[model samples]
Every structure is written in C-alpha cells, then in structure tokens.
Target: MKDLYHPAEPSLFTGRESANRAYLHENIRTVDLRSESTPPTGKVPALFGYACDEGVRRNLGRPGAAEGPRAFRRGLGKLPWLQEAPDGLADAGDIRLDTDRLESAQQAFSEGIAQLLRSGYFPIGIGGGHDIAFAHYKGVRTYLPTGRKLGIVNFDAHFDLRSPGDAPHSGSPFFQIARTCEQEGFGFHYACIGVRRDANPQVLWDRAKELSVLTVAREELLGSALQASLKKLKTFLKRVDAVYLTIDLDGFSSAYAPGVSAASPMGYSPWEMMPLLDAVLGCGKLVSMDLAELNPAFDTDGQTAALAGSLVHRVLHYPGLF
Candidate 1:
C-alpha cells in the first residue's frame, strides 16, 4: 500500500493563506491512508489523485494528464471556503503509476478508494483519464454490500462503453465495469448526460441500448429539452442504492473546458449543468465522485483547470450532500 501511495505536500496547495478567512488550502489536511487514521466524527471529504495517463495514451488521445492531479490542486488552492467549515478536508495524496502497465495502476487506485470508503471518508478522485471510472466503481462496489445496485452517472460526451479490445482505455471503463458486475453477479446501472450524437458510433449506441444505459444527449440539455433530461436523470437516480458521479471535462463545450483528452465543439455549457448537479448531489446517494481528463497540455491560460477547481469547490460546498 505504501509503495502505491505518495503523501500530499503543502507545496501543492498554495494560495493566499490567511487566518482571518478560511480558504480550501488553509484547512486541508494531508493524510496517508496506508496507515489507519481515526474516523472523523462528521462527514469528511478525502481527495485522492490518480496520477497516470497511460489509459489516455492507449485510447489514442493526448497525454500529460498524468500531471492533472497537481494542476487540479493548484487550480483549487486559491478558492474560498464558503461553506461552514468541517473539522478538516482530507487529501490522501496521489496513487502514482510507477510503470507502463495501466491495469496495475488502476488496481492500486481501486484499493486506495476502497480503503477510504472503509474509513468512512467521502472519496473525491482527481483523475488521469476517464478510465479511472472503472477503478472507482470497482472500489465503491467492493465496499458496498453484495448485490447492492451501483448506478453510474457520467457527465461525458462519449459513452465510454467501447469494448476494451486488447486492453482497457479511457473509452472502455464503463464497459469494463459492466463486465465486472456481470461476472460478479451484480447489476450495472448507468446514465450518461451530455452525450454527443456525433461523437459516438452506432456500435457504441447499440452497446448502451443493450445495457439499458439511460442517456441525455447534448442537444437535449441545450434548450427546451433540459427539464425532460433532468427528469430522466432523476428517474435513473432512483433506481440504485448508491451513485458514482464522474465528470469528464470533455463533456462540456471546448469553450468551457478546453483542456481535455477529447474536445467537443457542440458540448453544453457549465451553466446548463448546475441544476443536474444539484439534483444528484442533493439526493444524498453519492458514494464517490471524480473529475477526469483535465490535460494541461491543451489548457489555455489554465482556464479549464480553474473550472475543474471551481466544480470541486461547488461539490464540497453543495448543500445536503456530505
């Protein structure tokens, strides 16, 4: 466990530190989950970084997302803590990928996530790619009671249900998770928001249909169809014992989130996603969540990274969810 974990550093979280006002960095605590720590009396969110992009490379997308965790921290560092502060916000550090094998890294990440869940911490994963979803789902499912249905709510442009081919990649996480659930005699419930019709092939659509994956297309969330989309999301949310929320930056218009492995020109805006986010986070069913595919290589003036940071800030401050 120690070999896979790297402790968080204060240097990574740098902002205008002040005693008078509480900022995210000012109160964040660095923890080593490899060692047992006392469970917090109240809800505490623990941030863990999956610092590997081999999945992105394998998926034929851009690299450099391996640095995404650091960028996300730097992006979040200066944000003000508006919510009534908790005892501490935990940073469990990065699950570093020390080799070329992405599978091993993903397994290590799942183990770390399972540990956090067992410790009674709300795990928030900062990702190297959307592939982290498979590992994250595995971790959450492992921690939950057997036969409990795990619903996946993914805000992404692509279905990510593509077959793993020879090995799993960013595009194959959901399919991989579905397979895992099937092999283990559990259920796979998935709802994908912000799907782009142009982005997915017919085969992938067929796969979603076969899996009964509920999807809210990009166009539906653009105008009058948004409420209908929200209704669909709500219905999906009601069907599972717990939900795993993952935001692939590419789900948003390239204008809103340009620093991603995949960029969509016709994606929806962040403003359009607020109500949906509120619906999910307020449901109190979220077990774990993640932000994926924030590749610094394509980011312009750190805009996407900052947006990613702001999203996490919103999640932490969002009412009704721990």
Candidate 2:
C-alpha cells in the first residue's frame, strides 16, 4: 500500500481568502495514508483519488481521466463551505498507477477504502475511470457486516455491463461486481438510472435482464415521468441495507458535462437529476459515493470539473450523511 500511495498534493487546494467564510480549499486536511499515524476515530468524509485510466484506454474511450482528481480538487476548493460540516475534510491522497496493472492498483485502492471505513470515515472516491466502481464495491463489501445486503445505485448513460472478454475495463465494472457477488454467495442488487437506449445494445440489455438488474431509462425521467421513476427508485432502495452511489459524468448531457470518456449529446440535466440524488442520500442508506470520468483535457473552461466538484460539495453538505 505504501508503494502505491502518495501524499495529497497541497497546491491543488487554493482559493480566494475570506475572513468570515470557510472554503473547501481552506478546510480540507491532507493525510498521508502511507504514514504510521493513526486514522481518525470520528466519522468524516475522506477523499480518495484513483489515479489510473488504463481501463478507459482498454475500453477504447478517449483517455485523460487519470488526471481527474486534480481537476476535481481545483474546482471543489473554491466553493465556500456553507453548511455545518465536520471539523474539516480529509484527503487520504491518491493511489498512483505507476504501471499498466489495473487489477493490482484496484486491489490496493480497495484495501485503502476498507481502512477508511474501519476508521469511521465515509469514503468519497474521485475516479480515474468508471472501472473504479469494482474496487469501490469490494472495499464496501469488505467493511460491511456479514449477511448485510448491498445496493448499487449508478447514474450512468450506459449500463456498463459489457463482458470482460480479455480483461476488465471501464465498460465492465458492474458486470465484475455481479460476478464477484455470485462467487461469494451474495445477491447483486443494482439499480441503474439515466440509461440511454442508444448508449447500450440489445446484448447488454439481455445481460442486465439475466442478472435481474433494475434499470430506469433516460426517457423515463423526462417531464412528469420522473415522479414514477422516483417511486420506483424508492422501492428499490427498500430492498437493501446499504447503498453505494456512483455518478458517471457522461450520464449528463454533453452540454452540461462536456468532459467525459464518452460524451452523450442528449442526456439528463443536473436540475433533473438532483431530486433523485437527494432521495438516495436522504434515505440514510448511502454508505459511500464516487464521481467518475471527469476528463479535464476535453473540458471546456473547466465546466465538467466544476459540476463534478459541486456534486461532491452536495454530498459534504448533506446533513444526514455527516
């Protein structure tokens, strides 16, 4: 773990100074996960960075997401801390991918997440690729009590259940989680929102059906239909003891989130999705969360990163979670 981890870069957390206000950059503390120092005993939101996008490269998507964490921090840092939060925030640093060994890197990251959970900290993972979902689930499973059911709620344009033919990639994280659950004698409860009909194919849809995956299509959330969709989402939430929420930037319309591994011309807006997000977070079942695929290279004036940062901010401000 020490070899794979590095201290959080201090320079990324900088913003305008204010005498009576608190900004994220001003309050977030950088922790050296590799150090011998003891972990926090109180519940706090800890940010973990996965600095690899080999999965995106292998999945044949435009790859620049490896640098997502830095961009996300830059955008998040400037926002003032509005609500009452824990003493401050903690950054456990990044799991650097020095080689092409995505699997090994993910394993190390999962271990780190498990450590955070054991220390009573809520993990907020910033992604290198959508593939981090597998690692995130593994960590949560490791920390959760035995026999407790885990629910996965994903906001994505694609189902992400593609078969891992040669190896796993950004397109196969959920499928990987399903396989892992099956092998371990646990049920896979996954509910995917914002699925674009054109983004996925018949075979993937068939695979989702085979796995008994619950899906709410992009169109289902349009206009008045969102109420029905929310009810369906609430029903799904009742079936699990815990929830792991993941947001893929591409799930939003390209106009709102232009920097992602796969940008969709038509997708849901933040305004349309916040209600759903609030429902999930307020339900008191959310255990961990992540924001994935923010590619700064393609971002227009840092719009996508700011959006991702705002989501993170929302999580931090949610009173129920803290």
Candidate 3:
C-alpha cells in the first residue's frame, strides 16, 4: 500500500517490429505511481525490479549490481517475445535503495513482494544482488499460511551460508534465513545447485552439513554427470511443498554470463539448466522467483543481460505459452 518503489525508467527498445507481433517493448504493463496501487487481475505475472547492491558492497564484492534492475529490464524489454506477451503482465517499477538503511530497505522489498501476492499477482523479481533473496523469501514466508513448508532453491556458485556479524551482508542471508526457520519451528530445506567446491571454505561446507542442506556441485552440472544430479534433484523436489527459486547470475559460466558480481570459470551454460527450470516450474510449487547479480558494468556484449532476459521470458511463458 506504500509507495515503496521509484517509477522505473521506461526507456526501452526502438527496434523494428516483426510480423509475429511479439515484442516486450510494445507490451509489458509497467507500473508507476498510478498503476500498481490498483488491484491486479493476476492473469499475468507481476514483474518488478530490486535496485540496490548494498548487500554486495557489505559483502565486499563488486559495486555495479545496483544498476542490475534497470539493466535487466532493458535486456528483457527488447527481446522478441515470439508470441504476444500476456495482457496481464505488470511491471511494478523498482524498489531502489540509495541510503545506508539496508535492513529497512529489505523490509520495504518484503512488503512490496507481499503486496503483489495479496493483489493476486505472482511476483517476478529481477534483482540488484543475491542478498535480495532473503527479502524475497521474507515476502513469501509472510504471505503463506502458517506451518507450510518453505523450500529455497538457489542456483548459485556459493552456499551463501556465512554467519551474519554485527551487520548482515550478501553472504549472510541464508544463514539468517535458516536461523529464522529454526526459530519459527519449520524445516530449513535449502537446495543449492552449481556450488563450486573451491569457492567455499571448509567451514561453510561444515555449516551446510549442520543445516542438512541439499547440494550439487559445479562438476555435477556438467555433461554425463548431470543426469544423476537431475535425478537427485527430482528426489529433492518431492520433499518440499512450495519453492522460492533464486538465480544468482554468477551461477552460470563466465562464458555464458560474465557480468555478475562474481564470474565463474566453471559455470554451466544457462541452456543446460533449462530442463531443471522446467522441472521446477512443472512441480507447480514455485511461489516467488528472483534473478540476481547482473552487473552491467562487467557485461561484455550484453550477452548476460540477454540470457537473463531469455530466462525470464521462458519463465513467464512456462507450460508453453510462448
């Protein structure tokens, strides 16, 4: 109900139209002060941007992910939709954080996300950093009925299980989340894919064991080994009721997604994970979803942004809409 977001800049594509009549630039119903306050029909999934990277800064990573929200929008807006984007598509502008109030900003994000859900819209968060995943989860946790299982599936390179110190940083969200789950007397069933063994220290791995977190390593997402992991993922998926799926762009190989807070040499191509995404959506348990860590500053040819956009397009059209 509050004006939690700054109206997103509508500066988008100026491309030639195709006969297919399927370009996002011509369609996405972007929310401004005037639009989001109105009740959503929920026929279309609500799209929004999280424009802050203070978490990345606190975690001592690169600084440009603050620009991630708009950059991703630019990439998403220009993609040829192949089919008309559904009429219900709503862009709820962006929640921008420009001050030192990261905690309060996260609260605002949580509230905004919750509002979307209550208004009958499925929320799609294009993020500023991976720490925003906590806020995303907060919204889902708040809106769902009590005692429902909340499963978090992160497509990332690190476990993100670092303990929060005097302040919470990007690396500390999952720790905070797991702790919250414990305090709330719920299962902390977190499954992480593409975790690079070398990227995390022994202590983090120990922490994972302590939390009983399910994981698949970077090596496992590759060639022949991936099949077994996919089966494992199926087993993993069967155990959780609803899911909050988050994608940290750094989860993809630097070749496929170089513009992230942390680039990875061993990351898998985004296409390789398509089946997993399909399976996750097919389970019909996906609640809130997010894409994080797209750093336009490091993006070489806009390829990462394009991939992020493509992934979103696929998500919006799941079950073969497009």
Number of the predicted model whose lDDT against the real structure is largest: 2
Q: Please tell me which model should have the higher TM-score, number 1 or number 3.
A: 1
Residue range 1-322, candidate 1, lDDT tens digits: 5677788877888888787657888878877876888887778899999998999998999988888999999878788887555566899999888677898888889999999999889999998988899999989988999867888999999999988999899999999988988898888899999899999999999999999999888888867898898898998888888989999999989898889998877888898887888889987799899999999889999988998998988888887566
Candidate 2 residue-wise lDDT, 158-203, digit = tens: 9999988888999999999999999999999999999998999999
Ranking by lDDT: 2, 1, 3
Off by over 4 Å in 3: 1-4, 18-20, 32-38, 320-322
lDDT of model 3 at position 272: 75
Q: Model 3: per-residue lDDT, tens digit, 1-322?
A: 2445776566753345666546776666666533546675544677778888888888888889888887887777766665435664677877888786778778888888888777777788987878888899889999999878888888899999999798887888899999988898878989898898878999999999999888888888778988988888878888888888998999899998889998877887787777676778777788778999999999999988988988888887676332
Q: Against the hidden reference, what TM-scores do the models get?
A: 0.97, 0.97, 0.93
Off by over 4 Å in 2: 36-41
- Looking at model 1, which ten-residue stretch has the lowest summed lDDT? 80-89
User: Clashing pairs in model 2?
Assistant: none
Whole-model lDDT, model 2: 0.89
